[model samples]
Target chain A: MRFGVVRFPGSNCEQDIVIACRYLGIDVDYVWHGDTDITGFDAIVLPGGFSYGDYIRTGAVARFSPVMGEVVRFAERGGPVLGVCNGFQILTEAHMLPGAMLRNRGLKFICETVPLRLERTVCQWVDLPEGTVVRIPINHNEGNFTADAETLARLDANGQVVLSYCEPDGTRAPGGSAPNGSANDIAGICNERGNVFGLMPHPERVVDPEASGTDGQPFLTTIVARLAGV
Target chain B: MARYEIFVTYKQGIFDPPGATAERALANLGYDEIESVKIGKYIRVEVADGPNERARVAEMCDKLLANPVIEEYRIVDAEGAVSAR
Candidate 1:
C-alpha cells in the first residue's frame, strides 16, 4: 500500500513519517499541503510541526490550507488518516476529530519520549492488547486536549479515547509525567467513526531507538498489517 | 449594512490554561473577591445589508472562526451595524 505523508509549509516530521512507512515496506510520497488530491494513496499521515508558526492557534491556519480540503473529503470517504502532535491540533481544528488543543499547562515546550497506555482497540490502527504501554516522543508547546463535558462524556462512552499518559515505570503519571495536563491523562483519541486517529505523541520519532526510540514500531507495524490484509 | 457578533468561549469542561494563568495573576494581586475567570475570543463582522446576512456570518463563525468541540459561540447581534458600539 502507498502511504502519503502530508507536508505543510512548516511540517518538520514529514520525512520521519515517510521513513517509517518505508521501513514497513510501504511506498511513501510527500503530499504538499497545497495539493487537494489524494487519489494515489491508501492511507494519509499528517506529521508533526509548527505549521503557520502556530500563530493565532497551533492548527488554526493550517486547517484552512488548500490540501485540507482533500483531507476532509478523504476522511468523509472512510479513508484512513493518522495525525501526530501538531497534526492532532490540525485534525481538531478541521473538525475531523473532537476536542481542541491548548497551550501546555506548564506553559513551556516539552520534548521527550513518554509512556502511553493503550486504551481503545476498536480503531483499525490499534492492534495492541489493552493496557499495553508504548513510549513515544512528544514535542510541542500547545498539546493540551480539551472538550466540553458533554462531548467528553460522549467520546468516553463511544470508546473514542485511544490512549492515556503513563509514567516511564509503567504506572499512571499524575501530573508532571502527563506533560500537557490533558483531562484524564488523555494522550490520543479517534473520531466516533474510528477512521481517523489523532494524538499528541510522535510515533514516527520512536520507530528507531538510535533515531529517537523504538517504541513506535507497534503502531507502524499494525497499520502496515492492516493495509497488507494480514 | 448587516452586522453580526460572535461570542466564543472555552468549552465547559476543557481547562483554559491561558485563562487560568490570568486568574492566577489576579489572585497574586490580593484580589480575593474574584471567583473564577475564563478567557474567550470575540469577533464582530459587518456585511452588506441582506435578509440572510446574519445567518451567513454565524455559519462562517461556526465552520471557520470557532471550533464547536471546545468552544461555544453565539451570534448576539445581527441588526444592521447600528451606531458603532
Candidate 2:
C-alpha cells in the first residue's frame, strides 16, 4: 500500500516514517503541507513534530494548512489516516478526533517508551488482539489528552479508545505507568468511523530492531495487509 | 485601526500544569495566603474598525486565537472596556 506522509514546515519525523515504510516494503511519498493534492495515495500518515513551532497551541496553526483541506476531505470519504504524536494533536485540532492535548501534569517534556495496551481492535491501524501490551516510545511536551466526561463516555461507548497506557502484564495504569498523565491513561484513539486513528506514541521509531524493537511493525503491516485484502 | 487585547485561559474544569507549578512555587516561597494561580495567554490584535468588528473579533477567537473546546477567551478594547468574553 502506498502511504502519503505529510510534511509540514516543522515536521521532523517524515523521514523516519518514510524509512520505516520502505523497510516494510510499502511505497511512500512526502506530501507537502501547502499542497492540496493527495491523489493516488492509499492512506495518509501525519508524522510527529512541532509544526509551526506549536504556536498558539499544538497543531492549531497546522490545521489551517492548505493540504489539510484535502486531507479532511479524504478522511470524510473514509480514507485511512494515521496520526502520530504531533500528528495526533493536529487531528484533534482539525476535529477529525475528539479531545485536546494538554501539557504534561509535571510541567515537563517527557521522552520515553511506555507500555500501551490494545484496548480495542476495531481500527484499521491496530490488528492486535485485545489486551495485548506493546512498548512504544512517546516524545512530547503536550501529550496529556483530556476531554469532557460526556465526550469520554461517548468515546468509550463507541469503542474508540483504541490504546491505553498499561503495565507489562496489561493492567491499567492509573498514575504510575502513565507517562504524561493522559486522561484514563489513553495513548491513542480512533474516530467514530474508525478510519482516522491518532496516537501519542511513535510507532515508526520502533520498527527497526537495532534502534528499539519491532513492536511497531504490526501498526504498519496491518495497513499493508488491509490494502492487500489479505 | 483599533487594538483588541485577548486573554486565553484553560476552562474551569480543565487542568493547567504550568499554573499548578507556579502555585506550588509560590507556596514553597511561603505565600500560603494565595488562594489560586492560573496562567493564561495574552494576545494583542489590531484590526480596522467597522460595523462588524466585534463579531469579527469573536469569530477570530473561536476559529484561531483560542480553542473553545478547552479554553475561554476574553477581549478588551484599547480603552480597557470589556468587549467580549
Best by lDDT: 2
Stretches of candidate 1 off by over 4 Å are: A173-177, B1-7, B42-51, B74-85
DockQ of each: 0.53, 0.86
| lDDT tens digits, residue span B13-63, model 1 | 667888898889999999998789998877877788887766677678776
Cα lDDT of model 1 by residue, A79-180, tens digit: 889999988999999889887887889687998777888886467778888788888878988887877778878888888888888876657754545778
Native contact fraction per model: 0.64, 0.73
Candidate 2, A1-230: lDDT as tens digits: 68999999899999999999998899999999999899999999999999999999999999999999999999999899999999999999999999999999897899988889998646888789998889998899999999999999988888899999988899975455677888889899999888899999999989988878999999888977987889
Candidate 2 local Cα displacement, residue B31, angstroms? 0.5
lDDT of 1 at B44: 77
RMSD of 2: 1.1
| Candidate 1 local Cα displacement, residue A94, angstroms | 2.4
True contacts kept of 2: 0.73
Name the regions of candidate 2 deviating beyond 4 angstroms.
A174-176
